[model samples]
Target: MEEYEIAIIGGGPAGIMAAIAASQNSSSVVLLEKNSSLGRKFLLTGGGRCNITNQKPIKKLLNIYPQKNFLKHSFFTFTNEMLLSLFQDKGLNFIEEDEGRIFPMSEKSSDVLDILTDYLDDVVITYNFEVSSITDDFIINDKIKADKIILATGGITYPQTGCNIKNYSLTSQPLTDIKYGLVPLITKEDLSDIAGITLYDVVISYKKSKVKGNVLFSHVGLTGPGIINLSNEISQGLDYNLLENDPDFDIEIAIDLCPDFTREDLKEKFTNDFQLKGKTMLKNYLKLFLTNNFIDFFLAQSDLDGEIQLSKINKKSKNRLIENLKRFAFEITDFNRDLSKVTIGGVDLDNINPKTMESTLIPNLYFAGEVLDLHGPTGGYNLKIAFSTGYLAGLSASEK
Candidate 1:
């Protein structure tokens, strides 16, 4: 039987960082991975480019997470700036894209993984070591004994990447109800007519939650950052089993095609355009405000004649057009779980020490990454959480 001072399970970003941190403290560390190699899911982030972290300020960054106060310590401890700086010092160049998203200059997620793994020279990395059991004495699989254990096993999303929640044996700690997070919504409306069209800076709202970003028209429904973010907001407390069993189970969402302008504003614009392009067809006039394909679908949905002249449009038809543009309503029936970016729930936050990432219910047992109930929106927020919490957990575990 082999022994070590620290055993970090699940070699995703969190486990990898935990092993690195523990090894830096001169503690013998072994990183146990279920997969053949490390970072299988990590390479899939940001479409393989890897949006490492957001460059937003701490205050603004904190607002993204649902549990802001709980993450305050970890965010302050290992900030986005610090994460970027760590790579920068190690000769990694990065580029900042839209919405302050930072990506490696090489635009390869493998490069980011390389930097992380390079730091774990002193740590033992055991592949295909799925831990079957963990005793209270801190022994794993009856083979490895450790003073402390860091469960960096990620949430159940990409199971092929080795995220099997069924394999987890920490029944002593309370695991919160899990749901799909940052998943795309499957709309009831068939948007096949304008499937490839993307609306930029559009507003998608459900109840009081309104999200503004790009929305993509898919064959099945709406997608892209705008709808995905709104899905995250409305998906909370949703019963997935109920959603699966009841086909009628769904939530209604409203999309503002022209969010920058109000209905009255759109009416005014239409009035002016009608005066200038009086002889122009209604569909031709709509081209100024919307795409050709979307205009066809919009006109058909509104039961309006696209062949009619702009000047011939009546007050009722014009009002309906403006209203639809301002508030296009649809029903969201289900989520695209296959493309879900993150898992929403994990071990309840109440049972974990936010500052140290240690389990309050179990001594010398720590949790990090998606295994905890912490998650943020798309664009590197979740990755930062993984890295930050992993660092804190490893640092705390290495101490006496």
Candidate 2:
């Protein structure tokens, strides 16, 4: 067997960081990946321009993680400042966006990957080798053995990115369920005919829940940063209600097209437009507020005539219009988990020592990245978690 001081599995951001951190401190490090090349998914992050990390303060960043406790110790070990320095030292500077979202200075994920790969020049890498099993005795053919192992295999999202099934199903310590995020949502409405209709400045909210954000309607369903945040909540509800076959865990999603305007303001605007341009059709008049197709559809659904004169408008029609604008509700019939952003449940956090990311059940075994039960909303939160955890995992493994 080809024995080494460290054996790191997966070549995504977390795996790569583990390899780099471990190799920088000690020699005899081997990074194993099942893909033809490293950073397969990394290349497609942030719409091909990877969002590296958030520029938010450490305290604020902690709030982003659903499992914040899992990150508590790791953050103290390798802070975001450390992460920034690591990249900047390798010539990959980051720039902050509107909401403090940090992206590569070159605005290219490839640059981020190149820097990591370049920094880990001394670490040996084995590509196209799927890890079927891992044991304390030794790793199987494609021979590699080590004093410690770090599993950084990612979650179920973007399965096409060469993420192996075995990563979530390692014979030694398997993971739980995985969910998707940062992907388009499937709505109850038959949006197949109206795909591509983009409604801007809309407020989407889940009734009586803390979930709410901007919503965009698409042919597949609804999508936006807001919907992805709600997926985690909805997935948990489903898991708890699994036994109730007829359980209706449906969520009522509301859309406010003109969130800034009150019902009276909208009514007054409609009345003013009607009296000012009495000859113009209602469809033609409302086109300025929304797209023509959407305005036509809204009017059609309200059973209101567009060409009718201002004098013909009544109280009932005006009330219906205001109601539609203020509260447009859609029943979430079924949720598609295939396109979620992060894997929700994983190798339970309780089983791993948060301080070192080392497995409490199995000594010398560590887990990092999406393989652990930690995820956050889009905005460079997930990547931050990966770096912090992987750094701790690498340091802990190397010390042992």
In order, how many clashes per candidate? 0, 4
- Candidate 2 — which residues are off by over 4 angstroms? 136-142, 171-176, 192-194, 210-213, 240-252, 262-281, 284-293, 331-338
lDDT of 1 by residue, 21-128 (tens): 778785499999988999999999999999888888989989988899999998887788777876888899999998888899999999999999989999999999
* Residue-wise C-alpha lDDT for candidate 2, range 121-198, written one tens digit per residue: 889999998888776665744478777889898886777887644566574664555544455556676776656677
lDDT of each: 0.85, 0.77
- TM-score to native of every candidate shown: 0.94, 0.88
The lDDT leader among the candidates is: 1
Question: Could you tell me how far off, in angstroms, the CA of residue 308 lies in candidate 2 after the best superposition?
Answer: 3.5
Segments of candidate 1 deviating more than 4 angstroms: 167-169, 240-248
